[model samples]
Target chain A: MFSASVGLSRNWEPFDAGEEIVINTLEKLEGEPKFFLLFPTIHFEKNNGFQKLLDGVFSQLNRSTPLLGCSVAGFINPKGCYTRGVTSLAIADPDMQVTIALGKNAKKTPQKAAEEFANMIKKEKSKNNSGVLFLILPGSTLPKDIFHRTRRISNPLLSSLFDKFFPLYLALSKEGVAKESEFIDKLYSRISEKMIGISAWDNNLGFSNYQFFGNRVLQNSAVGLYLSFSGEITIKYATPLKIFSEKLRVTKKDNSNYLINEINGLNAPDLFFKELKLEKKYLTEELLRKITLGFPISAYCGNIFFNRVIGLYSDKFLGLTTALNTPEIYISTASGSSIINSFDKVTDGGEKTNFVFGVSCAVLLEEVGSKIFEVKNILEKKQIKNFLFLFGGSEHFMTEVTPISSQESSVTTFF
Target chain B: MSEETMLSVLEDLLKEEDVLAIMLARKNEISVSPPPDKFKLKNPSIFSLLQSTMNEFFVVIEKFSSQGLDKIYFELGEYELMFFLIGGDTALVSIIPALANKGLLEVEMENARLKIRELIQKGV
Candidate 1:
């Protein structure tokens, strides 16, 4: 039998929060958990706090249990949405087996890291076992070297000029994300099977996000959990996007296909504005945020279309969060009602299961705000008693034909 | 407002760059802005293809009328075609370069569709 319990601690102190989470979880879990998943907010990472939190957790449970997780923007549980504190999911099953793997230097050498991560899992799992891969990696594309260099510019005038041309820096940062996508592609090619997970994120979209492997805190790395269960596993996903514009061809793009330079013989931004009937003069930071939240570019890949949220743009280019493999794309928008309604749609039609692991895009959580409680209500209506939902920067899932990385909400239920 | 005024409104859309042609079909009547000869020499088969496609599109519009479908867009060879339904029996079609300012053109077409709808409602 499969049993799962979620533990949440809102204590301000990191060590106390960790202890409370373990005590809270162990009180209801009945037995020693085989696997433990941690989803802590960035708040605990201050002043070596993550290590202290992990110490507290280890103080309570066996140090050998497979534990893997990452810092999140926030998370949702039956209790409600929380932006601060640590939440954990502990699972105990007699027929389920899990193996943990870690690949370092994900940003610098993605292909090598992917090989290490995949090779570890492949060597550990038995040949006849049907395994599911859960991955968490650093999601930020902000180039640390450039950012530190820019910070060292002491001249006021030079700093102001750099600020004025910030979009260029943003475009450069997007190249890292393109590399990460390539890394994911490599992982998919090596481990061609079911996969579902998210990328680590922080509250402010900063570079403070960290992944947890057992008692250690890691950055710029990929962590995986290979689970082979003898029972049924159901995966449900929802990304209700409405297509608004007709198909537009990508006439030109950067080498990585992450930075689009031209579309339909016009500058990427120019074509985007023209299609939306907006003027260039009215563009502002606020307007850009609204545009990114409302209108995301949807590119067709394999047999499905995946969304690529616009993260950076200038007069000459449009930087997307994910790589675009196809030349054809359509402008799409998501409404608040549609996002909320997706909860019901995703939770529906699946066999009734008590244990569920959900991952949603942090941007969507920020967009929906307090309306996220409706998701908890939907889960309650579906009779899901114990579940853990995390909000990360990006969500990943494997389609029938290929792997897809996009801004989506998904739930993986094990019965 | 008469058909001449409606045609003039569509002519304004041609002011934008790369807009090849505009066609307005109302029941048994048809109107093409900039005349057919201007672009007929450049691409002679465009008009015939538009005529045949519009007939089949009208049939589709009738079938999906209950769903309140108002717009249809598709790419044909090197050009893009956008068809907007004006009232029950009238359709406004614009043919433009594949890379034209589609967003701005959409707004312009909506304005033109509204103007033509008012004219048709007035028994022009």
Candidate 2:
């Protein structure tokens, strides 16, 4: 029998939050939990709070309980949708095998770090074991100088112009998604198991988030949890986006292929604004956020369309949060109604779900705001009783032959 | 609470950037911030319609479930309407732009509702 429970603590004190989380979860869970998944908000990282939090957690349970987690923007559980606090899920299943692996300095050496992570999991699992992999990688890591430079620009249009003219400087400064993509590519080369996870993020787009492995708190790391289970696993996703523009071909790109310089033989940013009928000079941070939330670049992955949020933009180029493996793409838009309605269809298929673990783009949280609680309400209406839903910088899942990184939402249901 | 004090509370809620209007309704009486003429000129029937709908919806919910209705939200094209049930027969209604930061607004609304409740207890 498999048993799972989710707990959340809004206590400001880190140690208390950790203790409260364990107490709340263990009270509902049966027997000894095989694994604990922690999702702490970035607020707990202050004053070495993560370490103290871990100390409190280990005080209650076994010292060796495998725990893997990362800083998230916020989370939604049975209690409520919260922006600040710690939430955790505990699973007690004797038949399931859980293994954890962490690779450090992922930004500095992605391929090497991924190899270290993949090799650890590869050695632990037999070839015949059917399982799913959960990953938590570092969020955007724009260098200090570049981040400060961008912060100093009060006008977004000027910032866009600056990035467009000095592409090399911006390229050298940002290393989050590009490095993470490389890490995923290299890890897939070693392991063939289906993967689903998210990149850790803070409420602000500050790019400084931590990952937890056992009792250790880390940054710029890749953490993976492989669960080898004999039961069934169902993967479902919701992309609250629809095609807004006709298909356009990528005519020019940067060396990394993540930056689009020209689309349909025209300047990428110019065409983007023109197609959306947006005034370039009037662009502000709020407007940019609205565009990122409502209008994302969509491309075909397998049979379904995968959406990528715009990360960086300049007059000369458009940078996406994830690199597209295809040249054909279209702009997609989402409304408040569409976003809320899409959650109704997320768990449509017939499957007896025992527990659900969900990861959604933080952009959705920003878009919905307090309306996020309505999403939890919708899931409950679908009869999903036990679940932990988190908001992160990006969501990741694997297709049959390729790994897909998106800004939408995905759920991994265990039965 | 005096009429001036009640108006002050409603005015404070309107200070939020995206909050277009605010109304406090109890039984058949309704108090609208910025008065009814100035803001209601855009949508004359929405307020009364929403009030009636909320009451009807509450009746349906009370009949079907043991849980009390706490809040209701409606996304109407470019605008969003929210209702927060206060004590007694009173409720707070707010109209905001669709893109407003609802999470933050919810906290603000809760705070406003508490203030309104306190005022009501003191005799509004």
Candidate 3:
């Protein structure tokens, strides 16, 4: 018999309690816990419980216990959001490699982190497409170098494309997560799946018989996880929806996590916003929301819509990292339907799902209301039990190689 | 909202051949065209609709030069659907999908602004 349980918990402010939940959840998952994943939902009721929670979790993992989890946007269980703590726990082989790390601690980019995390997978390793690397980075950092994706693809292709299997993921933080239950209902999944910033279909928690999470590797809290086997990890993404204006070359770049001496061949953020017919704040808010939604929000809270991002060419803003110039910088745009269709086709009662985090459109949130979050429970009910779904807003939760300046420190890959 | 415009916009954005209707809404009522059949305004006054779209989104109100500027959505079949916005109180709101040629859309959007201005003035 497959034994599995899930622990769901939350800590409201004032009480400042995360340690108790972690202790209990870890206790439940200890001995035979195949893989333990945690999605901490703070801010909704701020209480400084996170440190306690992290401390509790750290104490439990026994130094890299093959565990993966992240902070959540909103959480769910049989009951409502009255308290914060683990709701369930389980024991079984989801067949996934898991890792945990706070955003700041993960020095290298998530892809590299995944490579390191994958080595921890004892089960198997194959020359073919083993498993996909899931990168989770902190939302606050707003992942700087996503253009590294192309590099990921090319690297894998060289020696049978190990990097190709790695897809990038961002981790959204407090502001996004606090908005979780904004709309608990009213979303039309079948239709709006094409509407980015509206919905995500990749994962289903609507409880079913089988399990998900199998055959997948997980990187929790911006910590990367890579499972090595032979099956291909198919990737579909749309970034940088609109160039907004002529693509500019980066004159000088370095990743110091601060906007220091940045020279864009163009007027920088100003020109880009002018082309979009908006202001700087709009772009920041929109992109931040997009990162939270894991997609772009065309219609603001169902108000007015625009083209969403498909992908980004980091070098376009190359000055942010390498002191070189990236000529072609384009933002991707596409409908939400195809993504949903893919999720629809791939999801199954018995299919194992590893890790999934996404952002839903604010307008969709307005449209669906509470359904935006209630879907968590619905999905939990619909998906196979094996799958571990950690949902949050758009925040790049991966470690990117930030080329430091002459005065700063250099961060090379670990392991 | 005209099916043609809605169809084109939806096709480009969601890649959907089928689009019911799009709306620009707020609390209870319509600031533009009367609420369509399936659409109903909210409980608040007229400003609610305007606030819904612009307030939190870091929106701006620009009195168009012989044009208008408003982007909002409305309700359709219990589905608050539609891409058409209520522009400039007396203006125009245009939809530009990222996929299509960016330059061309910019021009067309400008023209649409003029047309919306003329219409708003004529009250036709």
Each model's fraction of native contacts:
0.00, 0.19, 0.00
Query: For every model shown, what is its TM-score relative to the native structure?
Result: 0.71, 0.77, 0.38
Task: Tell me the tens digit of each residue's lDDT in model 1 across A342-407.
Answer: 777766753366667778777677666545667777878877777777888778877456777887
Against the native chain B, each candidate's TM-score is 0.84, 0.76, 0.35
Spell out the clash pairs found in candidate 1. Answer: A274-B103, A274-B104, A275-B103
lDDT of 1 by residue, B1-124 (tens): 4757877776666644456777787555554455765442257588677765666667777778668977778877667888888755678888876544353356447657767877877888
Candidate number that wins on TM-score, 2 or 3: 2
lDDT of 2 by residue, A1-415 (tens): 8899999887768898889889998999987888888898877877899998887788786777899889988888877777767899999988889888988888667788899999899888756667889999888755555653132344578656655554464345435554667789899988878888899887645457888999999888999899898855666777888899999999998656667888999998889989999988988655765675578899887777788777766666777766665799999988767777766666564225777777888777777666777877776777778878888878888746777778865544445
lDDT of 3 by residue, A85-152 (tens): 33333344444333322222122343333334334332343334334333333332223243211211
- How many pairs of residues collide in each model? 3, 3, 122
TM-score of 2: 0.77
What iRMS does model 1 reach?
Answer: 16.4
Q: Total backbone clashes of model 3?
A: 122
Q: Which has the higher DockQ value, candidate number 1 or candidate number 3?
A: 3
Sort by lDDT, top down from the best: 2, 1, 3
Give DockQ per model, in order. 0.01, 0.14, 0.02
Candidate 3 stretches greater than 4 Å from native: A1-4, A10-31, A44-48, A54-66, A75-91, A94-135, A139-265, A279-326, A331-388, A392-415, B1-124
